[model samples]
Target: MTDTHEKRITQNASALDLAMRLRQMISAYQVSQAIHVAAALGVPDLLQDGAKPCDHLARVTGADEDGLYRLLRALAGVEIFTEVAPRTFALTPLAALLRSDVDGSLHALAVLNGQDWFWRPWGRLADGVRTGSSVFEPIFGVHFFEYLQQNPAARGVFQKALAGASSRAAVADMYDFSASRRVADIGGGHGALIAAILGKYPQVHGILLERAAVLEGARRYLESAGVLDRCDLVESDFFESISAEADTYILSQVLHDWNDEAAHRILSNCRKAMASDGKILVVERVLPESGVQKGPLMDLNILVLMGGRERTQKEYEVLLARAGFRTTRVLEMGEAWSLIEGVPAE
Candidate 1:
C-alpha cells in the first residue's frame, strides 16, 4: 500500500474508534439504568447460587422472557453477568455486588438510582445549572428531606444508599476515639458511623442526633451493631440545635448537603453544643483545586437535589473559622472522603 493511502486509512480507523467511544459515553446512562433494573428485579439475588435460564428468571421476576433475555445479554456484554449457556446467565463478580445479602452490596444504591425520587431530578439538571437551585423541590413539590420524612419506604432506601456509600469501618478508623468519652453523631442517619466507633471503643458513649422519623431506624441499626446500649438516639434538627455537649462530634457526609451559609450555621451549632475541649470531625469529600474527581459529580448531585455544593479544604477552613473553630488537621482517608478535624477556637 502507498504510504499516503495507508496513513489516510489509519486516520479513518482512529476517527471511527473515537466516535465509538463517544457514543458509548453518551449511552452510559442506559447501562446504569439496566443495572438498576436488574438489581430492582432481584436478578443478582436470584443468581447468587447458580446460573438460571432466562425464562425461569422472567417467571420469578414477573418480566417478559424475551425482554429479560435481552437485558441479561446486554449486561453480560458489560461483564455484570455471564451467559454460560443459551438463554442462561449467572452473576459475574461485578454482578455479585448487586446481591442484597452480600457485604458491601450496591443493591441499595442501584435500587435508589432507579427510584423516582433519585432519577427524576437528573431530568432537570439543566434547570439546576441555570438557576443554581435544587430542581428536586420544583419537580417533587417538597424539599428532599421533607419528602424523605413523609415517605418511609423512600427514606429507608435513602439510608441504605448512604450506608453503601460511606463505610462505617473506614470512618471509625479515620479518627482517634480513645480520648472521646462522649461522641455525638449529628444528622447520623441509621447511626452506622457511631455504631462503628462505639463498637471499637467500648468506653465511649455515643449519641446520634437525627430527625424523629429516622431515629427508629438508627436505633435498630445501632442495636444490630451491638452498640445500642452505648448509644442514645436523639431526635433533633441540626439547623435549630444539636443539644449535645459531647467531646467529639461527627458529621459524616452531612455538611455537603447544604450551601456555604447553611454549612456554616451547622458548624456554629456544633460549636455552641460542644464542650470546651471538644473536637468536630467533619467527614466529607474535599474537592481539589482543579482536576477530575468524583467530588465534582457529588457536588453536582447535591446542587441538583438539595442546592448544596461540596467544598475544598480552604473552603472548609473558612467555614470552620467563621463558625469560631480552627481547622486543626485534615486526614486523608484514601477514598473520596476525608476527615477534617476542627476544634473550638481559643
Candidate 2:
C-alpha cells in the first residue's frame, strides 16, 4: 500500500520482464535449429493437410516418437507449431511458411542455414570480427562460393533458398525495361531476375553470365519461366571478365557477397562489357547510415560468412563511381531491397 513498496514491486516486475526477454534472445539458436530439423524432416509438409498425431508424423519422418513429440512441444512454445491435442501437432502460420510447397517457403533456407557447412561458420564469428575478415575460408579451407561450386547439393539448396527469400520477379516491377535492348544479369543464380525481366519485356534479350556450376540450373529455371529462348547462358566468371555485351546489367544480391575490391572488379567488368550508353541496376539491401537497424545483423552474418558488408546509399554511390559509373538514383523495390540505378560516368 505504501508508495515505496509499490515502486519496489514495479521495479522487480520490470527486471523480471527484461530477464525473460533476454533469455528468449539467448536461446533463439535452439528455436532456429529445432525449426531446421522439423523442416528437414518434412514435418511441415506432412502436416499441410491437417493436424496429426506425433506417432504418425514420427513414422512418416522416420523419427523417434518421443523425440518428435518433444521437438514439436518446444517449437509450440515458440509459436512455430501448435499442439492441437495430446501429442498431436498442427502447423502455425509461421510453420506454414516452412512448407516446401508454399509460396515464399523458407524450407530451403532452414535446411541450408542449419547445415553444418553453414552453421559452423557462426562459431568463428568472433574471429571474423577480430580479424575484420570472413571466417568461412579459414574454417572450411575454401571460399564460400568455391565451396558451393564444389558441392552441388549445397549450391542447389543455396540457390533455392535465395529464390524463396524474395519475389524473384519483383524487381522487374520497379524498373522500366522497355527501352533496354539486351540485359546482362551477371552472376545471376538460377536466372530469376533476368527471367522476370524477360517475362515483362518481351522484346529484350537476356544474357546470363555465370560460372559453369550455376549455368545448368539457371538454364533449367529460365526455361521453366519460358524466358530461356530469349536469354543466352554464358559460362564465365565475373571476376576475370564478362563476354556478354548489353545495354543494361543486373547484379542482384551479388555484390554483397564480396569485399570492396572484388565488388569493384565486378562492376568494372560490367562497365567494360556494357554498351557506351549503358546502365547498371544493382539490386541489394541498402543499409541505413546509423542507429539500430534490421540490416546490421545481416551485415554481421555476411562478415562471418563472406567478408562482405552491406553498404549505405552514400557508400554505394562512391563504389559505383569507382567502377566508372555515376549513381543516378536509388529506387525502393520491395520491403528489404533497393534498386540502385547507375550510368557510365562521364
Q: lDDT value for candidate 1? A: 0.90
Count of backbone collisions in candidate 2 = 0
Candidate 2: worst-modelled 10 consecutive residues by lDDT: 162-171
Candidate 1, residue 39: Cα displacement in angstroms equals 0.6
lDDT of each: 0.90, 0.90
lDDT of 1 at 104: 86
Candidate 2, clashing residue pairs? Answer: none
lDDT of 1 by residue, 315-339 (tens): 9899999999988998888766789
TM-scores of the models, in the order given: 0.97, 0.97
Q: State the lDDT of candidate 2 residue by residue for 267-329, as single tens digits.
A: 998899877799999988888788778988888989989999888888889989999999998
